[model samples]
Target: MSDIFNQVDNSIYSNAMTFLRVPLVMDPIAAEADIAVLGLPFDIATSGRSGARMGPTAIRQASINLAWEGKHFPWKFNLLKKSKVIDAGDLVYSTGDAAEFTQKVEKAATQLLASGKTLVSLGGDHFVTLPLLRAHHQKFGEMALIHFDAHTDTYDNGSAYDHGTMFYHAPNEGLIDPQKSVQIGIRTVFNEANHGFNVIDAPQANDMSVEQISTLIKEKVQGMPVYVTFDIDCLDPAFAPGTGTPVCGGLSTDKILKILRTLTDINIVGMDVVEVAPAYDNSEITALAAATIALELMHLWTVQNKQV
Candidate 1:
């Protein structure tokens, strides 16, 4: 009999649902893959709408639309050819228990990092980044954060498990250096008094050229290990209406892509794309956007490795 698991199946509609049609290997270390894709499917911490729990499935399914593009455009080489990438599937945890979710995610991440695999995560909500940061910090020490969102996620008044408060706790835990961090596309209200992070608000980001924006980001992070977290609500509701707690007047998808494309040299060690709730989406655009951004991140990793 032929080895069915090793057979190539790139059909857009008929195949096992893995991100970008990559092999689904639950044990990434044993497979000796360079990149591991993991999903966090818990959104109990969301303060607004709840369907972000379904985000992982939506994002993976939408990635089928991008499977046919071997080189992913503009980029000079094929991503999967340059590096071995596999979907490790979603994190399994006790439903509705926030503490358990945190423990499981951090432990899983630590294991993957210890095995020397670059992790690309898909979020259930923005809260997931805290544990992810904890795992990355243990392996790489303190990191510079590159956050893309409509909110700073720095609210000090929220409960222990709120999604809007991860950054507030992350700095306190010494997982990231706030002074070395940059928060982009923020339009919502946040304390300006002592937030520490360099804020490039929505209006400011729109006014600046992509080169200027990329330069500012590189200056802030400056040779430190970087962790990039993109909250889908950073895009205006017109571009990503499927997210919970979306604000108006945010960055356009085109502009964000341009900025990301220019940052191929930054030392990004880990990344995640969050808040893609498909129930509110029109024509699957939000999930597709998330998938494309995730793929771009992989290309960034591939290019960085090539440079090294």
Candidate 2:
């Protein structure tokens, strides 16, 4: 049955489930692919809703809707053909244990990075990026961050496991250089006096053209290895209502795509799409948006690697 399916194009509803129908390899270190997709399916750190733990499954299922397209539009080449990508399934850990989850994620990510493969993770919440960042920092010292979210995730008042304080921990741990990092689509109130990251709030981002925004991002992270983390709440609630903490004023799906398309020249080393909670979603729009964004990130990676 598997061999027969391999001989034909997978229908949108058929075949083994993976991101963009990519092969599934459980062991990341042993996977012989240039890109490895890992799912972080734990969301205990959210201060609002709890369903983002299901984000990986929803995003992968929604990605099948995009698999039918041989070549994603606005780009001239086929992504899978240009790059060897595989879904490494989800990271397993003790249920509801945040410490175990973080340790496992960092260890797995570290192993994957050491084995010479780039990682694109699917998050349970924004906090997942913290562990991934730790792994990336070990591999590529002091990288710049390109963050997309309505909240800055830089609060100093939250607990160690809070999703709202990853950035606060990131900078203090030296995982990312705040001066070189750029946070886009932030609409929440944060302490500007001590916020070292170059922030382009929602209103500011909306006023600027995609060219201007992309240029600013490139300028901020130009000379450093970059890691991009996108939270679904970065989009306006109308565009992505399936997130735990949806903000009213946020960037549109189209605008975010345009900005990502313009960032092909940067040294992006790793990336993740987080905070997609399908329970609040209408017609799977949020998951689809995330899937599309993840696909665009892959294209961007391909461009940086000169695969296209």
Candidate 3:
């Protein structure tokens, strides 16, 4: 058989693969033998730029270049030695069908969740989060969300699904309890009609220190399960220029990284890094940033899973 696992850095602990790492795994069951990964490349309906469909590919390619650190964290957990992470590949979908794609995501994610395997999700856009949350809610009811973005993604336009209207549909479906959730690093403009979906606004976020923000989340999200959905637009366009939407005067990259690293004890069941549009990117910096955050998510999984 082919090599089961390979090391990105020889000195780092080895992270295993089941058999082979394909480009994108269309079928979650057939493609995912052990650990599964699925991509949701659905960015056609974005209100901002129209190229976030390339997010999954760009993230995968950038990940290939990252050197895995041997030590999981300073705490001495070794994820590379213990965890068996596989590349299940991206999900398959037809062009120009949002509802169909949502159903497809729900079916595939349900299987993956039932199998008791961790799925590392790469996004097509922010809208994908709603369907993923729907699938997970069916498995683990009423999960808390830790959303990081420039906009509070809770808007129900009384229409179909799209990037801007995802969070609004979540509570209506009973998937998310806005009161139990916390939104960080948000900065943008919105209308008065989009209210009632509880979220910590960015104007308030901007005034507080990072420590204060982290402390607030710790207090608010205490004793509940959380899913982290990071939209690349949460960071300033100067820091991440390659997203479907680029909001100005947002969180800096280093500041966001510090925040993720500080939440050492939050129970992050699953995470998704989204809205990375490569078509607008010149240096490919945004993809690399998203991939790095994915690594941080892996670290969070290792740290939290071991504690359990």
- Which structure among the candidates has the greatest lDDT? 2
Model 3, residue pairs in steric clash? 25-89, 25-90, 39-90, 154-168, 155-168
Q: Looking at candidate 1, what is the lDDT of residue 227? A: 99
Q: Residue 85 of model 3: what lDDT?
A: 64
Candidate 1 lDDT tens digits, 205-287: 99999989999999999989999999999998988999988899999999989989998888999999999998899999999
The estimated TM-scores of all candidates read 0.97, 0.97, 0.85
Global fold similarity of model 1 (TM-score): 0.97
Q: Pick the candidate with the highest TM-score.
A: 2
Residue 52's lDDT in candidate 1: 91
What is candidate 3's lDDT per residue for 1-308, written digit by digit as tens?
44555423332223212111233344556543434556778886588788888898887766654545455344365555555566666677888888789998888888887877666688888988888888888777887788889988665563576688877888788887777788876666555464554455666666777898888887777777777899988877887899877878787777777778778788776678899999887677888788778777777776667542
Question: Model 3, residue 68: displacement in angstroms?
Answer: 4.6
Considering lDDT, where higher is better, how would the candidates rank from best to worst? 2, 1, 3
Please rank every candidate by TM-score, starting with the best: 2, 1, 3
| Deviation from native of the Cα of residue 30 in model 2, angstroms | 1.1
Q: Could you tell me the lDDT of residue 16 within candidate 1?
A: 41
lDDT of model 3 at residue 224? 72
lDDT of each: 0.92, 0.93, 0.73
Q: Relative to the unseen true structure, what is the C-alpha lDDT of residue 215 in candidate 3, on a scale of 0 to 100?
A: 86
